[model samples]
Target: MVVLVQKLLGHFVRSEAYCLVNGKDLPRLDINSPAIWKASVEVGADTEAAMSNWEPAEKRAFRLGARNFYLKATGYLLARLPFQNMTLRSLRCLSPNAREEESSGSELRCLDMKLPQVIQPGDISMLMDEYTVFQLDTLESAENIDECWRAAFDLKKCDGTTKYPILSKLVKAVLIIPHGNADVERGFSENRRLLQDRARLTLESFNGIRHVVCYGERFDSDPSSFTVTPEVLKVVRNSKKRYSERLALQKEQSAKRPREEPEAVPNSEGQDLQKEVETAKKMLTNAELLIAHGLKTNDLAEVESGNSLLASGKSRLEMAIQKMAGSKNSLPANDLSVHF
Candidate 1:
């Protein structure tokens, strides 16, 4: 049991790019894509002969565990396979004309991209030669690869025309691919669940429910900072009471699956960034709603309140930026990506 667990876990711990999404840095094609391809290549290298008297049952269990993870990671990567292929083709060296190569890893052979007339093959080559060398040089000076990659895209030349437009586009496309959708996918999944029971939910109802959930979370995280509204308290307390009663009843009545162990939580810096980002979003939405309502009713007070919200949102954003600047070694996840 222990050996099987180690073998299965070893693959995942190394290939965290399968699930950890880092929006700030550039994507390494060697690491991010074709996880199963690498694993399959490796599986044969580790034979049953290495382990004395390895039984068929043990082999079956190991294979099952590995395959389960392999299928999920590969499926996720393959779904975005075209994007991954094009990114590789774009970034690789010029001599081999990846389009012409038989071994070009494109699962979908045709990129079928409507190429922008401005960005030609020559442009890609020139950028690759210059930018790749510059990125490499940055490696010598900077402490790590990540710091160097960020420095590579620190665009300074902002004349009338955007500087290195084509390169910037490529960087955004390739570099910004998430290590994993671990953080972002949950909200939408919950949204679907929230709406499942109600077929006729209006836009207002949808937004309101979402806000309640969001506000509820914020309130839980820092009770001192969050305004404790009576309505929110009543709803939370009542909901908790109901849920506790139901959960206990369900456990008594039927078969209960063991609770999955919780995943590792991000550090404090990350949590703060996430909170500020959410606060900023909430404030912006409040501002929008106020302004819209004020316009509809021609109410001066409501408009004034909205302007205040806009200011508050800006302040939250600035604070988040300050936190980032303060903690370079342990900077937070990209929260601004959610909004703009």
Candidate 2:
């Protein structure tokens, strides 16, 4: 009974027809109603033939029972189901095969009405054009939801610019909406197992473990069933080199930290400080690339190493900034000393 009502509500929310739930058409699950039951079930040739044998009192009882059931079902749904706002109903426009008549300019215009910050009024025309092109050109053979959006995104205009930029943005925003709270639930489960008494792990290390577990699960459930490809072997081999580089970078940066804050520096030292800053920037860029690669490959260890390297580079950069600040502060003093 609950499931049936939920399905009906889902249909109502997704329905393109405005004012569907209003007036006499509101959903009511009165399965016990004698007329409805007779219509739904296998019966004699005619409606009169089907219920002719029932006593008048029995018929009245059945009608009363159906009324009570309808009230109960309505109450249950009212308590459980979320109130459907117009914006949620507007999502039908995002559907791959949503017709032009169904998703007209007026309907699309209403999307930004509730949330002006997200969907601007000016974006409506471009979004409409993109959606039309998506329907006509891209949606014909698209096998899946993602594919339908991807094809629309790849469509090009006459001048070679992207054909559906606004549509693509809309699709991306919709795609990121979590289908359920499964991931959040799983995170809590993972935390419970990892955070047992005395099993202390740094935040970075804990995250690395979670990533590895997630990566493993994506392949196969059993650890032994995991297949290590050549690419995996390559990453493993370079892991030591990456770790060494991180350590060296950290050591170098630490060594360069001003022990006793230098108040002044000569022109040569100022030039050297600028050079160090440039070098730190380059190192930071490399570290960022390393982190990107790790994320692309789902390698948490590599990501952690990259993070360490990035921190080291940031420290080096700060040191260079300090030197520059001190140089500027003592410039007048240096000039006066040179004159004496």
Candidate 3:
């Protein structure tokens, strides 16, 4: 029972990318190895030979099971491990490409889209060239990913600056990725504590407190141990000034924006009808004035225009009154009608 458990566990432990890259004590497992079937080398001649002793049906079942396990485990690891995908494994570990004929084609295209800033389109060729040299340099020296990146960063040009600036940045970004969510969980806990007692905190205030907490935690410093240097005093003094400036800038930006006219409130049917009545009254008064002017000057055109205006005003007034009456008729009988 112990031997069976160890054999299974050995494969799982060896499957880890970190263990492989770091050259951990556990030897890499081969599916064909007889040791996989039995704990000790003395137990079997080979996997196939040992399987020959079993029933034909058992042999077929074991092969099928192994095939399925390999496929499923490979897929699961590809998602979590960087540079361990079938195409990408060649980049970091110098693993032979599955398709060596197509090796000349862009391998960067298959890169996980997690680092857009680090891997720009124009720098693709340069990045590949740097990675080529990086592989050769770390062929034996690199014990782990951290050392590999440190070596990459150590590569200097004529001016003593990093040879592969972009690649170095990419490596740094990748290495900084946390293996677990412990830090994230802790951050959520801290945020929860800050928000207790129905506390009302502004975004700026929350961020400031978060920054202070992070700074103290990172340096392992107590609040009392913090030094109040001249720079700190200056920053403190100018804080209000900076705040005022920010407010002024915000106001200026708001003033520059095009003002949108307020939406006109929709009038109810009753209100619309009332407005129409008022408009008709105004039109009638204008028509009467025109008629009076025509009578005084004896102009036929003016008199004709006044008559047309008067007809239009009368029609509008009648329509509005009819609509108002219709609306009233649509309403249900009130309780007062029961008394009647």
Candidate 4:
């Protein structure tokens, strides 16, 4: 069990990104590492030995042997920790027998049983100084009420033997009626109600229900604080709107553009057309070269080259027209000689 607990602790430490243990961040340790195994073994051995010595016997020669053993073991465990001090005498006086004392003799015996020293108001005051007190109401006819009252009164006694009065000094401790799994049964009832056949539940639905039960008030009271802001919504809406408008404009432009038919080349004009094509190609080439050089020098020479190319292509078209007019006598080629 100790090994299992230690392994679980290690697993939890690794799974939680923000968790710290013993004032240090968790180190990366193999689950089956030798050091972890050794620590688990040591802890298990110590716990087992303590439990074995502390285990209650079914029958004993001494009247309070089992009780005394329990008290001693508890005291040993408590003393090892950085908390309250405990002793055997204080333990016995807190037992059921001590409270039934009806005479002075029995009272003196109870006082005598208080070992080491008796606790006093100063002790109680010191404990109260560090702790808070809560009052609970109970039924007058409740079972074991007398026993409870006796225990509470005995706790106030300062005598060290039977009573140490440390209860008064305790920072905090809870006391309640003895009930057999009532709270557990109530929780099961609530679970059943949430998971009934009428609910048609999935894992998500169950989780939602659980969250509501745990933090519904906080959620319902201030939903905006836990939800996305209006500014975020506005940004999302604007981005989507801009994207849709850009797509629509592209579609409109595509619809408006006219498609041109492929033109055939005429054998009579082929030489002149070829010359024009060559001149256009050279202009394009020069423009690309200029663009490259301009890019290297971070200048606008490429833009000027492109404009000059356009002007040169226009001039070449005018020269081709004049040549055609000047050579009107040279017979025009038939349409059949033209090839697309």
Compare the candidates by TM-score and give the number of the best one: 2
1-340: candidate 2 lDDT, tens digit per residue: 3345544333223233223444223334333334332222222256437567999887666655644655465557655654455555566565555644555444555664543445577887777776666556624565466776677677788999988777677667656653456854555555446433212233344454555566678677687877767755555446545656767988999899878776665557656766566666665665677578777754544565456656666777777677777774432223221110
What 10-residue stretch in candidate 1 is worst by lDDT?
Answer: 105-114
lDDT of each: 0.50, 0.56, 0.52, 0.40
Candidate 1, 1-340: lDDT as tens digits: 2223234334533545433432212133233334423443234454645634777787767766665665566435434444434434444322223223434322112221223333465665655454444333422355453454465456455565544455556445544443456634554355546644243333344445655677867767576678768887666666666666766888876556666777778666767676666667776676677668766754433455456555666677777777866765444355565452
Candidate 4 global Cα RMSD: 33.1
lDDT of 4 by residue, 1-340 (tens): 2233334343222334223332111223333233432222222455446556553552232324433443344335333532222222233333334333333223333433332133353454433322222122221332353455444544432554423235432211112211247754554455545533222232233334544543534566476655444754554455556666767988999889897775776556645554554554454454455446545543332334334443554455456545655664343443113211
Q: List the residue pairs that clash in candidate 3.
A: none
TM-score of 3: 0.36
Q: Rank the candidates by lDDT, best first.
A: 2, 3, 1, 4
Task: List TM-score per model, in order.
Answer: 0.25, 0.37, 0.36, 0.16
All models, RMSD in angstroms: 23.4, 18.6, 26.0, 33.1
Per-residue lDDT value at 208 in model 3: 47
Q: Model 3 misses residue 214 by how many Å?
A: 2.4
Worst 10 residues of 4 by lDDT: 169-178
